[model samples]
Each structure stands twice: as C-alpha cells, then as structure tokens.
Target: MFKTHFHSFAIALLLALPVAVSAQDQKPEAPYNAQLIVRQPEIGQGSPSFVPSPQVRGMKALSDGKVYLVSTDNKQLLAYQGNRLAWKADVVGSCPTVVGPRKISKVLLGPKTILVTVGERTFAEVDTATGKVKVADGQKG
Candidate 1:
C-alpha cells in the first residue's frame, strides 16, 4: 500500500512540474507600436539669432539646406541660411489686397520649389534658391 501511494504521488508531481515550469517561462506582451523621431536643433555662434521679421507663420527647409519662413504681418516672406536672415521679399503685387488675418497652414518642400498655404484660401509657390515668391493666389474667406 505504501509503495503504491508513493508511485501515484510521484506521477502527479511530475505532471505538475512541467505545467509550473511552462507558466513561469511564458513571456509578457510587447509594448504598443509607436515610433519617435528626433530632430537636432541647429545652433550657431553668438546669440541665437532669429530672423529679423515680424511674425513667422510657417517654415520649410529646402533640399539645398535653405530655410524659408513666411511673414503674415506685411504679407512678406523671408529666407534663412543657418541662423542668419538671408533675404526678404513682399508677396503682394502693386495692388495689395488685404489677406485678412491669415495664418500659414501648411508647407511643402520640393526639389526646386516650396509651396505654402495660408488659412484655407491663399497659397504661394516660392523659388527655393532665390527666395522669390513665384505666385500667390487667394480667394475670399
């Protein structure tokens, strides 16, 4: 009787050992799928120079490493090389119409051109090399 009971207990222990080992070896679920991208801020010598313009509404970086910023106050645009302001130009023509408190909404940088949109109505295509406003089109809000 004693030997029979000992053999039955041994079989039960062996079966339970495998289950406990596997339960301990199981892995937890992985973290959620998300990626983070980091961009380094460019710093130059002397004080952190900001482009000498009124307000910068939007910005785009070109393939040639030039940065363009749009100024909404005077309906103008400015360019930056490193930390210095390279050039500035008026976007409006001889007959200036009110752009009506517009804010630059989007910017797309191309190989040779940059496109910027203001609010929902106005947009401009600029030459990345020359910092010239190639075209500015708008409609009433």
Candidate 2:
C-alpha cells in the first residue's frame, strides 16, 4: 500500500512540475508600437501629452525581455525592460524621417547591443543596458 501511494504521488508531481515551471519562466510581452508618453508640451499647450511627432522610428526586441527603439523626431535611442523604460540616449548622426527618402529603416539586436539602421546602413551601436550609443560606419545593413 505504501509503495503504490508513493508511486502515484510521484507521478502526479512529475506531471504537474512542467506546468508550474513554464508559468514562472514565461517572459513579458515585447514592446512594439507601444505609445510612450513624452514630457514635451505639444504646441505649448496645458500639459505634456502624447504627440504624433516623436513616434517609434524603429524597434528591436531581445529574447531576454529587453526592447530597444529609436524616436522619430529626435532620434533618441531608448531601451525598455518589460513595460518600463530602462534608459535612453541620443543617437547622434542618425537620419530619422517619416516621409522622406532617407529614413530610419529598422532596428537590429546584437549580442549585447542594439543596431539602429537607416536606408541600408547601420548608423549606431547602442548598449543594451546603459543605452550608450557608439556611432557605426553605415556599411552593413
């Protein structure tokens, strides 16, 4: 009787273990065209609000739940953990445009960095944690 009961309990525990582990191992949803609030007042209005100018120029999500992006108007590189903003930096020399020939094309994820590209060239190498941007030669796409 003792042996049978022990075997049944062990089997049940093993079957339920996977579900429990998977639930805890799930990652947060990656950021994608998420509307982020800007502190800048639009047209010198009452208060700072979400504006259409500083849109998400490019975004890249990592497997470790980090999302990196570039702003449309100022070309600011931003990093996010889960839904919270981690850090931000100015992407110097980045040519960002909404309706022009030279525009921000895409964002790529590196080993520990994020690459901001325009047209068919990479322009910035941003650190994943500190949001430090190192200007790259616009050679590789």
Candidate 3:
C-alpha cells in the first residue's frame, strides 16, 4: 500500500511540474517597445528541455535606442540593439550566498554601463557595448 501511494504521489508531482514552471514565468504586460527585446525560443514537441525563456521583470531603455532586460527565470541580463539581441549573460550568482535575481535590487545607468547591484557594497557593471562584466572595486575588468 505504501509503495502504491508513493507511485501515485510521484506521478502527481511530475504532472504538476510543467504547470508550475509556466506559472512562475507569467508576467505583467510589457512596454510598447517590449517586442524589441523579447526572446522566444522555438520548442518542438517532445524536446523535453527548459526553453530558456525570460521572465521579463524589468527593462531599461537607453538614449541610444539600446535596451537592457533582466530575466529572473534564467538569471540573465540581456542587452539588445534595436530589436536584435546583442548578448546575454547568465548572472546566476555573483558571490556565494548571494544568489542572483533575489540579491539584485536595482539596475542603474553609469556612463556607458548597466550597473547591477549585488548587494549594499558590491555591484557589477555590464558594458553596454560588449556585454561583459567589469567589477568596479578593482576586482575584475
């Protein structure tokens, strides 16, 4: 009886996985120019993989027509140049114990960089042109 109940519970949990994942990605309506930065992966039947979709959380529009989009689904920061994806980085966790998406509080603009706050003291400056992380505190460049 225990084995039978375990099997049923496992099946139920497996069935609910897809629904929970999709619901976690549901987000509010995007901006008028949201189309310019959205990414949709083509997933065929029976592929059985996470499609790396963005849970569009926040976006910043630059004066030069560039766009920066932050995704919590995959912990990524994507840079776009006029509706085309320039580059994307998997900013999962900058430092141990400070996992991304949750640690990140604010995204700011500094000259030609997008500053992603890691904590009260640390931040990562993503180059708007190259999409590379350049730490400001003499650590990385």
The local distance difference test score of each candidate is 0.55, 0.57, 0.56
User: Which candidate's lDDT is highest?
Assistant: 2
Work out the TM-score per prediction. 0.45, 0.45, 0.48
Q: If the candidates were sorted by their lDDT against the true structure, best first, what order would they fall in?
A: 2, 3, 1
After superposing candidate 2, which stretches have Cα over 4 Å from the reference?
Answer: 1-60, 93-103, 119-122, 138-141
Better TM-score candidate (1, 2) = 2
- After superposing all C-alphas onto the true structure, candidate 1 shows an RMSD in angstroms of 17.5
Best TM-score goes to which candidate?
3
Question: Per-residue CA lDDT of candidate 3, range 95-116, in tens?
Answer: 4434334455556654477776
- Which residue pairs does candidate 3 place in steric collision? none
Report the C-alpha displacement of residue 57, candidate 3, in angstroms: 3.3
lDDT of 2 by residue, 26-122 (tens): 9776454655433222333433212223563433343455655556654566777767889987664543422323444555565677666554444
For residues 67-106, write the lDDT of model 1, one tens digit per residue.
Answer: 5555546456666665566777665431124354455555
**TM-score head-to-head 1 vs 3, winner:** 3
